[model samples]
Target: MSGSPAARASNATDHDAEQLRALGYSSNFDRSMSLWENFSLGFTYLSPVVGVYTLFGLCLAAGGPPMFWSYLLIGLGQLLVCLVFGEVVSQFPISGGVYPWARRLVGKRWAWMVGWVYAWALCATIAGVAIGAGPYLAAMLGFAPSSNANIYIALVLILLSTGLNLVGTKLLARVAMFGFLCELVGAILVGGYLLIFERHQQFSVLFDTFDININGSYLPAFLAASLAGLFQYYGFEACGDVAEETPNPGKRIPKAMRMTIYIGGAAAMFACLALILAVPDMAKVIAGEDTDPVSTILANAFGPVGSRLVMAVVMVSFISCVLSLQAAASRLLFAYARDEMIVGSSLLKRLSANQVPSIALIVSGVVPALIVCLGLFMADAVATIVGFAAIGIYVAFQLIVIGALIARAKGWRPSGQYTLGAWGLLVNIAALAYGLGAIVNMVWPRMPDAAWYINYSMILTTVVVMGAGLLYMLLAKPYDKGTAPAGDAWELSRSGSHATGRATSQGFQQAQ
Candidate 1:
């Protein structure tokens, strides 16, 4: 096989040695994360938020008792997209993840558009996740009177996570593993308690009733609710962004993604079910004074002390989610920088001694921190950010699945160990259908109320952001075509290139 276009370009460079040194191509990032670490990263990536359950309640509020079925339906829809992602990651396990795959499958211009949008979405998501960490932490510490302090706490959390990522991927993986374990134990313990003590509530209520009186159609309401539930499944792609740092990335990246989805999805499903069952009355629970469902459930199950303990667990889970998001967002920034797609390519390409993208990490963290502060001025700030982040993620997913289909149609078979086989076509179709449906639901007008107005603001904000991306593409079209060398070994390996002085070997043999 021929070498990557970037490698060929590098070979023809007048300053070849200097270019290689600057790009950190000579340094190795072949660290092996254990299966446990992989699983933990995935789990923590979907941490428990009061808002997550509250969003489900909103779904229940909007779609009635059939919300549980909506969760399952959305889960199935996401599974199809996950399969598409699984195929791509297995075939091209590079740090750029969807960006590079889109490029190869659809050409550089379209890839640039997708990468730019994904990078922005990632940054926005980091801010949204960071903002989420604050309320949970404040709730745990009984800091209700000083709700404003949550922003300060969020800043601190962002800085701490940024520091951890700067230390190295190995350390990040270790932290993720610890967080994941805590989430698992906490989920199981809480879930088991709910199952044993709270089974008196009719399970049939969670699945049967559909009495919401929204102005929208039931299908649209279900889609809206599903989008909210679907947000819980957003972080599995984090594994793909860090593919370059993993051992045997082509194989392990895909495995990690698949397991992340299955394990995390299953855990979330159980947690949601337990929360539903624990509620004394669905209508009363929806109208309850307590805004935080997990705390409320625990307070009922084991009194105030138990509620505080659950709050503490939730705080840790939020921190873990923020950390994972920070790490993943920085990787996306790094990839965009390496490809000259972002504004400051030179700064983003700088790596620390530990091979971490230090500059990118700081900038990515800081930018979102600033954006999240906007929440201080708006009542529904958190909801708006969540909605915007969700839209950004869905757009990226659409681009990736479309790219995968195009690649498959052109006979671009992946030689990796984890192939998606004949299911790829079906998966792409289902994912596209789900994605389009969710987008429509999110933008549909709701009943004239405070919540509807808030939803409208979020929808408008998302539309503006997307429009801005389109504008950026138009103005930046000329610059987007300037190709830079793919900056890491995983990318080079995918393109059939070896580092200088490395022997020419097929597949993963060179690294091994």
Candidate 2:
């Protein structure tokens, strides 16, 4: 039958290569992931249940009931960012989301810097997500939430995701699909049940200002709460990261990016609303009486049995987040490596017997595992690294947005199934503004009592990431593989230390 497994596999691989050629590149990896899998990768990366669940308590503690509204604002802002990404990825459709887009649209050096920062951001995000899972695991399993336990669990979680990715894209796709069902359905059901039968407060309660701000100004308090939402919406660009392994990536990847924001954004908003409204006592929740307010809400709304059941789904969401995170990180590595843009490009691009970038996959896991190990001794490591994630990703996204704007201003137009038409400039401007605003808000320092590093952690960490990237660019000074001379290979010029090669085949002419 045409639908037989073997036949489908052959068709998929052929289609994938054909699509890659149409986008001005040749396929080097197995295209085992279906469109559903593509969508799932983004969805799980933007895993609403995991994002909202992890951030809910922190937002509540920071701004009391008013914190949830930031989700709405950030959701709308990030959607603009996603659309800009959609437009750009529609035109590029390269494996590395930011690197290829920036290289082609901006310049080679700019692309290298963006890729360096984004690569670390992705890795840090995986570690941050894993570390965030420890507390929930502790609450559900009766552990003490010790540093050692968190470190071990985070390491185990990263390894599990790494193993799944190493197997093949097909299995990863299947697991991601399963996770999509559990997290999305679990979110809807959990939210609906609480909204229908368990709400202790009215919808109006969210508008109330508890005046929890010690400085007497609500602005800072609300801004503090906004970080929670800001952190939740990134990683959707992950669809573009796996574009090489996806069939018809040009059109499908953009759609998946938007759909991830749409569905996951809705799920996060609804779930947070449910938890806020279902609080048995708002006074106690706001007064820090319920240390684990989210868990308390779930446990109170539904009995222990139901709460644990939902926690099980949350656990799945956490693993799914890590899987999607590591998978995207590996693709970013492979993409940059294949272009010979990084140190050890030859080794990093080597594929396994299964046609996967095995070294990239393992490197992706190892770096995050080390980050997790750092969390073992530093309890505050989770917040700082996640701060890096929350701020770092938005910065990476805005770099691309700025590049796209510069391209458009210089007469670049998108050629794809998705285009903004007359509103292209307008949308791009909005995206840039939103991205810049979010970054400032997240990076703006507030704590003056604590040490400099702790108070300005986000800003300081971001500077460190960028400074390190600049240093690497100066030292490594990797070559730019313009176009292949004959095939998909860039023959290094037998010349000086810095060799820029020309295309070996016909496609977009390499700028030299």
Candidate 3:
């Protein structure tokens, strides 16, 4: 490769091909998603409206008005995580966001575990998000919301999203763009109206944590409040999950990820603050009353018609979120299946005429439906499943972050256009620390009055999911025991070695 124009283009193409070849596949995706479309995918997945509207009441209940600070704190922490992820995705820019990043930075088995947790998380997120939307959907359709009814409605929503995912990327992109607009614009208009025209509490309420009922302890209440940020900031990695379909992925994916967090965080905080500030009775809220502050505030600020209108917009955002999560999950399945990793690899890796992963789509779609159906019987099952979705994604994130720090200690360096460079170590360590702390917060036993198992449900569910993943990897050994790569993609792209013209032949080398 020389300094010629054609040489640069050839080098870039070779880079893409080489990355795929190392992953044991040729290009199979459409790679037709524009920057805005890529941004929309992540934004819709993050879906400020989805996260905020779902957990706002719980967050408000946890710590009263001071919960707004939790969102602020969570945003900063997730920004750090996103920064670390940006550097990783900038280097890999592959499908299966956490899996590929960990695979390359760590090793195959490690990455398999990453994919394991992430895939389940994505599937569960699909279920959790759909079921969470049931009440709004039920209200919209004039159906009495019940556990059984919610299950049926959630399954129907899942079916719609699954079909939407299978249509075509072009159509998917159009819908995602629409969701992005509706969520961002709707959040601004609704929050502004609630804050300005229908304010019940003054701005000083945000600083008041006195009335919060964390058994008279501030730390526990703050930690509980942190759940909002925890749930809201993730799903931005949906950008990196679709990197293969993105043009100029190395440059664009990182930006898309950061934008997803920044923009989504803004919408979530504004809406949450508006609702918090508009609550008229803090003591009643803390006294096990006004359980549905989100819906209550919307209804208070805007009458039934206006609240229903907003609920309708939220419904659209929920469907959009489901569509994005399923799309991302299908890609995870497809990415692993391309290497014959999963149980139905051959089928899952098969592409439809539209160039989408056909069987993977079915797996991603149907599994969540089955999971959400559990809501019909199990007491508090939906609540626990929703908790799983939030914590599961966070666990997947930390796996990659942990792997990055390990790789860094062993001389791994950023090989992409975007990198933290001299500050990479500091950022990675801080992000890792934040992740570990957050994980503890998530797993902490908050339900003191409940049974032991029920109180530790999140920890138990996470363990079961991870245990299943580890067991599958131990038995399946998904990585091909191959030695044909001239040099591993990491080596090819990790430094200037691609230009050195050394070891471009065919010899396999593992990342570790």
Candidate 4:
């Protein structure tokens, strides 16, 4: 393997392919996504612009300016989750983020349930982001932000993303990279301008709750407002979702995951802070009068033409987010189908001539579009769907964390390039606790006067998705259809080192 540089590179790729074969899967993806591209995919999925803009108004109205602090809290918690996930993906760089990781760590039935919950969560997220962008899209085009317009615009964005996804993986990576750059720059420029030129509120206003409380307590309001922060911190797991399309995934994917949290979290925090401090009328916004505070803030700070331009940037962030979410969801579907762990395995697993999961991508697009259509019947659809998405994602994540802890108790140790060593247990426990707390906060009934379904949407949606999955697993037993091997594919040595550690290390070095 120690020859010319080109020879070394070829050897590294060959080793990666061999490792996939060892896992009982064929390498059909392009494997052309570089480490930067991988990071970009996760970054754009997190999409600070989209998350902060969409949730800022709702959070402000629910819990006052202090709710912004949830960003830091959720960021720290999600970073711990990212660390545990880094360890898992390093050992098992499977295509689907949570599904294959759960399958290998636990068993078929458990993984199936996790995948089902996660896939629907991704769809809900896709629809949520697209719908969030509708207002901005309407602003850019000088159209009214009505329910029908939002639905139609959301569908258009989904269709556009699916078409881009069908083209190939390289283009996906490039577009993600472009989106990341645009979002980062836009956030910096817009936030910087607002902070320097349009700041009105004192810095101490963040600690002021404005006496917004529910049921003789502000706790519920703050917890409900936590949704804003929780939604911003996910999508880093998208790094692991495209493991098959990435080179040296065991080493690079972990780094990409961590970077996604650090960078994306910082950007989201800065942007949210800028918007919060620069709002033209905080009292009006918190009083539930300024429904679109993002637009209001931008208009006041940047004038009409500049606001529209920034709105266009926001639209890019949304579209990029949808693109990344669709990619992750389709990859999960492809992985499940590849393992024959879902219905319509043969069709969903098929790769086009371009080596992309075209049919699965279409399904991904179609499902989210349908979800967007459902928004037409519901008031505050973005908020409801976002709550559902956040809860489902947390539950799915906890399943993996729980599975890993169970595996560890049975004497399994992570032996990949990234290992938590003796701290794995503590970190895993912390991640699980944080995830569980977030889920509870997300599902807690807050809107007492609203419809029962709206008030309990988060809990209800989780029950429906998980209950449906459980029933399907019991009746269909789709996991029994695949011959794919499960459980740990890599062997550990007497000293607790991976048997393929040398090859993996060399491959990563060659890739470097």
Stretches of candidate 4 off by over 4 Å are: 1-4, 215-217, 375-386, 489-497, 500-503, 507-512
Judge candidate 4 at residue 387 and give its lDDT. 62
lDDT of 4 by residue, 177-208 (tens): 99999999999999999999999888898998
- Expressed as tens digits, the lDDT of each residue in 230-258 for candidate 1 is 67776778888776666555556677777
Candidate that beats the other on TM-score, 1 or 2, i.e. the better one: 2
**lDDT against true structure, model 4:** 0.87
lDDT, candidate 3, 262-309, per-residue tens: 888888889888888888777777766888777677777777788889
Over 273-365, each residue of candidate 2 has an lDDT whose tens digit, in order, gives: 999898887777668787778878887877777787888889999999999999888988887888888777898888888777889999999
The model with the greatest lDDT is 4
Clashes of 3: 2
- Model 3 TM-score (2 dp): 0.91
Which pairs of residues collide in candidate 4?
none
TM-score, per-candidate, Cα-based: 0.85, 0.90, 0.91, 0.95
The pairs that clash in candidate 2 are 483-503, 484-503, 484-504, 484-505, 485-503, 485-504, 485-505, 486-504
**Model 1 whole-model lDDT (C-alpha atoms):** 0.67
Total colliding residue pairs, candidate 4:
0
Query: In angstroms, how far off is 76's CA in candidate 3?
Result: 1.0
